[model samples]
Each structure stands twice: as C-alpha cells, then as structure tokens.
Target: MKLKNNVLVTADWLKSHLNEPFVKVVDATYFMPGTPRDALSEWKGKRIPSAEFFDYDTRICDKPSSLPHMLPSADTFSKEVGLLGIRNEDTVIVYDTAGIFSSPRVWWMFKVMGHENVFVLDGGLPAWEHANGEIDTSEPTRVEPTNYQATFDQTRVIDKSQLLEGINNGTVNVIDVRPNERFLGLVPEPREGVRSGHMPNAVNLPFAQLLEAGKFKSAETLKMLIESALSDSKRNVASCGSGVTACILAIAAEYASGDVVTVYDGSWTEWGSDHELPIVSGK
Candidate 1:
C-alpha cells in the first residue's frame, strides 16, 4: 500500500538499492527490560548487508538523564550520526530484529533531528529474510565519517510540563501506546518505581493493533484505528512505557494521516515516576 508520507520502504526496495552509496541501512534493534537478546551482539552475528548498528540505548542518547534512551541534544545527534557515515543527503533505512519494534524509534529520532529522507523498513529484518535478501556475517567495515549536521525541530517533541499544559487547555490529544493492561494499571510496570496507569485523558491504542504479521496494516485500516481512538482532535501526542514504542505510533500516524504526531520523549517513565504528575487508572 502507498502511504501518504512514504514513511516505510519495503525489503525489496532495499535489496535493489543495496549497492548505492547514498543508501545507508541501520540495525536499530532494541530489547526491553526482560528480553534476553543483546542488540549489539546480534548485529555482530548477522544483519543486512552493509548495515550499521545505531545504539540508541547507550551511545546516542541523553546520557545525563536517568530515564531510558531520552533524546540527545542536536550536537550529540549530529556527531553520532556522522560517525555512522551518514550525510545530510543520504537516504537512511532503519530496521529491527523483531520486525517492527525499535526501528521506528530511530526513524522518528531522525525526523525530530530534521532529517527528512529517512524511512523505516517495512516488517524489518524478518521481512528482509522473507524476501531472500542477502545477509552479511563478516565484521562490518568502517566507512569514513561524514560531517552530518542535524537541525533540531522543537515542535516534534514535548516534555511533561508542555504536555500537561496542552492537556489541561484541551488543545492536545494524548495517545498512549502502552498495552491496555498497563494503561488500565492492571499490570505492574517493568521499570522500578514507575506507575502502571496512563496520563489523564490519554487514549490507549496499543502499538500492536497497527501491525499484522510484523508489518503495518493497510493505510485505510491504520487511518480507521487512529481516528477511532483520537476522535476529532488534530494536535496529537504519542506516549508509551518509555520513549521507544511511542515513535511507532507517531510514524504510523504520519503514514496514515499526512500530519506529524509529536512524541513525549520521556513518556510514562517520566510521568509515572513523578508523583506530582497526575495519572489516571481504569478506562
């Protein structure tokens, strides 16, 4: 299906353009708290040909923040991306091992940093395998770093204070992408000290609902699901347990409805941890 914003690129497309110098593939695999897999180790074992590992968890984040993988400053983003051999003119394709999981987070990160030519791999690594794409097991070759410049777009992100203000004023529609159980506070949060409920007035639209067999559903279906949850609101904000899965919602919304959905970078990790922030349980 053709998306309005072209946010996704198929495995076949990557395979055909694999040799192009301007097309850079990235392995953005990230496992949550209890997951046993180590992203860096897996990348070293096998990955798409010429794909580099984008370590959002450690290397490319706001290291000062206690929260998980918070957005790094524009200077940090620029330097890290430049080290990945990416230039401003390159077309980046991001993917993850678990089909459509953490890849969109990197994709959204690039967008927030004002890089418009980035796309997430549709169905991720599993899709590439399905398409009979060649995999490289040899150690990655280091490419010469480029002078990548990132222009941060402030409107693409929101903090807890700004989100609260917008919610209070009835100007923003907050879409919480956590599981229904977590959104309702029926299950304990994976992170220590974080609460299990959602933000006040936040609508829960689990990220899984937007995917079918590891790939996004048709644009028509995505539009339907998002609109049903959002109702009539236009100013959208996406949030999840940490900051990662919220990006899946944001990128999918952009694909479905040609408008940008701002991500709450700290998400529940920041909101639920602080007692001052109001959280509501039970839908």
Candidate 2:
C-alpha cells in the first residue's frame, strides 16, 4: 500500500510493495498476562517474507522499573534496533497476530525515537493472511546491523508524578485505554492485588474503538472519539492495564487531533498496586 502520514497500512498495500528495498516489515507480535502462544515461535513458524521480529518485551523496556515493558533507554533501544538491521531513514511497517493490538507499541517506539517514516500494518498478520497474502515458513536472511541512534523525546513520556500534576492543574487529559470492564473495575485485574479502577479524573476511551476490523478508523472518526473524551482539551496522556495498548491511544490522538500526547509507562499496573493513589470506578 502507498505510505500515508498516519499510523496504518493495509495488507494489500504491503503485498504490492513487498520487494521495495526501502520498506522494512517487522513482526512485533506480543500477548498479555496468560496468553499461551509464544510470539517468537509463531514468528519463526510463519511470517511475511523479509520481515524481522521486533521483540516487544525483552528488547525494549526500562529494566530498572518493576513494571513490565516500560519504555527502554535510548542507548538500549538504539543498540537493539540496530542489531535488527533497522536504520534511521528506513520506512518501517510493523504488524502483529491481532489486527491492531501489540504492533502499535513498536510504532510508538519508533516515533518516540524521532523517526517519522514508521507505520503499523492495519489488521496485522491475520488481515494479511485473510487476503491470501504470501507467508513464508522459512526464516528470513539476517543482515548486518546498522547504526540506530535514538534521541528519546522526554516530552512524549509521562510518569506517575507528571500525571498527578496534570490532573491537579488541568494541563493534560489522561485517557485510559483498557476495555470498559477493566477500566471500570468490574473485572478481575490480570495483575495480582492490583485494583481494577482507573486513575481519578481520567476519561475512559478503550483502544479498540480506534480500530475497525484491525485497521485504524478514519481521521474523522478518530477526531470525534478524541473530542468526545477530551472535549476542548487537546493535550492527553494514555494508559492501559500495563503500558502496551496505551500507545494505540497515543497514535490515534496524534492522527486525530494532532495533539501532543504522552503514554503513562507504568499505567494502572503501578497505580492500582498502591492504595494511596486515588482510583475511581465506573464511567
């Protein structure tokens, strides 16, 4: 598919240009809490030809944090991505088994590193296979690592303290991207002893709403969703059960409102664990 300014690309678009040297496809499949499928095994078994595996959990994260999959340091990210043959100017297309789930994190990672040519494969691997696209079972040829320098933009990330300040000052809109049940504290949290409620003053906007059949909704729909949640406010912070799906909201906000957005790296996994922090249940 022809590359666009926003976050997604169709399987058909990818099929048409699989041979383009400048286009690099990455398989970024990941799962939550108790998911049984091994992402690495699945990627090795079947993947789009020439695609590389971008391990979301192990390769990218803040190792110092107790939280799972927090954003990694620029030096760490640069080294890891560089080993995968990713360069500064290459156009990247990231995808996962689920249409619009885990891949957005990789897309967000590239963006946070100040790379603008990245895009997520809409509907991901399932969408591509459903369209009768070719999938090679053989492993991809490994290439020499390139230099990948990550210039981390601190403005794109929000910590717990920053979120509290935003809530008190009304400077940023906090968006929760978990499912309605999880966000409202109606369902059991995957993390043991973690409460199910959301951060106080945060709006509920599940990440799924931003997608349709694996692809992102139009900019018009995204705009409406953001406006509905934030009203006149433009600045936003996104959070999820952990920190994965929150990036989906961040990408959508960028596409829809063009607002400066941040992702709470610890998210509810950290907040819900602490009883001292305020959490409100129900919409």
Candidate 3:
C-alpha cells in the first residue's frame, strides 16, 4: 500500500481503504494508571471490523524490569507481530480509543523493528465513530501467520547509560512528557516509591500539550510547540510517566521537524526508581 506520508493517516482515508488487501488494522487502546478500562478486554468487546488487538504492554519490553511497557527485543518483536498475522509488505494501521495516544507507540514499534509501512490512525477510534464508520464487536478474521523480520535500530532507542551520557555531555535534549506536577516532583509518582521530579537538564513538554481534544494538532502548531522546548541543541529524546506516551511525543517531534527522535524505553519508571540517578524539581 502506498502511503501519502509515512507517519499518520486520517480516519476518512483509512475508512475508504478498509477493505484493501494486505491492510491490517490493529486496535492498540491503552489506559493510564487510574483508568478503569482494561485495554485487552475492551478490544475483545468491540473494535473495528477485521481489526486485531495489539497488546502494547505485553508485546514489548524487558519483563524483568519493574518499569511499565518497555521495548521488547527484535527477535521477540518479530515473533509476536508475526503471530498477529502481520507481513512485512502489509500496510498496518494502528488505532486507539484516545485519538493519538497509544497508537503511535505501536506505530513507532513497527518503525523501530524496521517495518516502514506502518501508520497511526489519526483521531483514532473516536474519529472513526464520528464519521459514522462501521464497527464490529465480533472477533476479526484471522490470517495464517506470516514471517516478520526485525532489524532493530538501536539509535532510535535510549538506555540508562546513554541517557546519563546525554545529560552530562549535553549532546541530546531530553524532553519529559509527563504532566507538570510529575515533572516538577510536586506530585507523587503513580508507581510506588519512584522518585519525583524531572531528569537533570531535561525540559518538560507535557504530552497533553501536543493534543487538542481527541486529536493531534496541526503540523505547524506541533512544530512550534516543540521548537519552544529546544534551545540551541538540535537532538531530541522523549520520556514520559512510563515508556508509552513518550512515543506520542516522539511521533509529534518527527512530524514537527522531520528529524530522527529517540525514546527512553525505561523512561521515568526506571529513572525515578533508581536512587543513584540525580533528579531535580520545579521549573
């Protein structure tokens, strides 16, 4: 499938192409700390016709780590995605209950795993519903498993060592995507005993600022928002409460500047928990 732009697609465009062959739709809805909705159960209950559930939390990550939803190994990623009936040549569209939150994480995962044909459904499920598009509560048609090759791009992801180096060397701009209170260390972290406050030398650009209602803002507006966060340095890395929403900021940064963005897979969940890492509070 030919995509107009690689990063995102509109609801109308996706609706028109729903029946196209080799097009796989993934329901990637995820909730935050206090939300009552269970993402997997909700996807099982109702989703777009022929859409499969991509459990963002389970599909990726170092399970041993206490941090939530970290990136998985390339081999693990390939196996899991292959089991979902995804092929290298397929045009994958990911959508979530929230317009532009969890879907981009899946989109980024595909990119990090070396699949370039994936995209996030702009405005997500709500946008589709608003357009009066058809939805199916029934289980989707399953295709035979296909071979998926993952060529992991290590540069697109940041680890603890790299994060520390970036901060000390001032080589990359670390942008925290948590809420102001969380970033400022004024509020207790949702995860138990994790230290509050932002990473040293990191700037705060809460993920919420990048969205309007249930959708992403205009490209120009997004660019401007990110521009204000940067000083003289050009390199950018994004982090959030966990690893999930950070991908949303990374997607926005990519759209805004067309620059390569890195995600701190462990993010605050790992950073805040470690007593050895330095932390600072307030603006």
Best-fitting candidate, scored by TM-score: 1
> On residues 1-283, what C-alpha lDDT tens digit does candidate 1 reach at each position?
1233479999988898889878999999999878888999999999998899999999999999999999999999999999999999899999999999999999999999999889999999999999999999998789889899999999889998899999889889999999999999999998999987988888989999999999999888999998876645557899998989999888888889876889999999999999988889898
TM-scores of all candidate predictions against the true structure: 0.96, 0.93, 0.95
Model 3, range 116-174, lDDT digits (tens) per residue? 88888889999999888888887656667878889998778889988898888879889
Worst window of 10 by summed lDDT in candidate 2: 1-10
Off by over 4 Å in 2: 1-4
Which residue pairs collide in model 1, if any? Answer: none
TM-score of 2: 0.93
Per-candidate local distance difference test: 0.91, 0.85, 0.85
**Strongest candidate by lDDT:** 1
Ranking by TM-score: 1, 3, 2
Superposed on all Cα atoms, the candidates' RMSDs to the truth, in angstroms, are 2.0, 2.0, 1.5
Q: Which residue runs does candidate 3 get wrong by more than 4 Å?
A: 231-234
The residue pairs in collision within model 3 are: 61-71, 61-72
